[model samples]
Target: MERYVDGFVLPVPTEKIDAYREMAAEAGKLWIEHGALEYFEGVGDDMESDMDGMPVRTFPEIAESSDDESAVFAFIVFESREHRDEVNAKVMDDPAMDPERPSEEMPFESGRMAYGGFRSLVSYEK
Candidate 1:
């Protein structure tokens, strides 16, 4: 039973890229120091795919499609849900968490920025 912190980020306007990048980098470092297992960032590009029929892929695919600048995604794995919750609480309460703020010039609506805590229902890896 592994716990993870998943985040979905949409970029700010072109003019704000530098500011956003700096913010995200600082945020990643803070999360790591606060107990995050891993942090990763990626940029989105245009692509064609049919996502209407697949609920699992719909959101991510659409996110990539519409993302002209970048979208940051991160995952932090914990030994158990309880531990995850504990670490998350500490992380949230830490003053360092404030540095990850999204810029005012964000291209997408703030409501669109999504985040969640997830437990591994099943996994296959080699």
Candidate 2:
């Protein structure tokens, strides 16, 4: 199967995780409603790594999260880049995604978030 994905990494205040989760859940529904194949929001549980001698950074280190913040890694799946674009366009147009939503209501700083689109290299399904 071929697939495209939009991924994100961000830091969310630990005290605001619940609020973040609530917002993310609603957004996930919107994505799905607009034709996303899958919408996933993951809050870090085991973000640290003992890579031993390997030279690599952990999610927390990469996101520059503080002791009072947690790293969030999320992704949305689509059948293709075009499909992703279509779904995202619809989602963007949805009233629930209105830009008027106050930034303060979000649990994380939008400027600090990282996002990207990727084409599938390998995909499998059971």
How far is each candidate from the true structure, as Cα RMSD in Å? 4.3, 1.0
Best by lDDT: 2
Candidate 1 per-residue lDDT, tens place, 1-126, comes to 344556565534545557666866876776677677767765444333556776354334534434354554445666566766777788789887665665554444556566667777886545
lDDT of 2 by residue, 63-96 (tens): 8899999999999999999999999999999989
**Which is the leading candidate under TM-score?**
2
Candidate 1 off by > 4 Å: 50-70, 99-109, 124-126
Candidate 2 segments exceeding 4 Å error: none
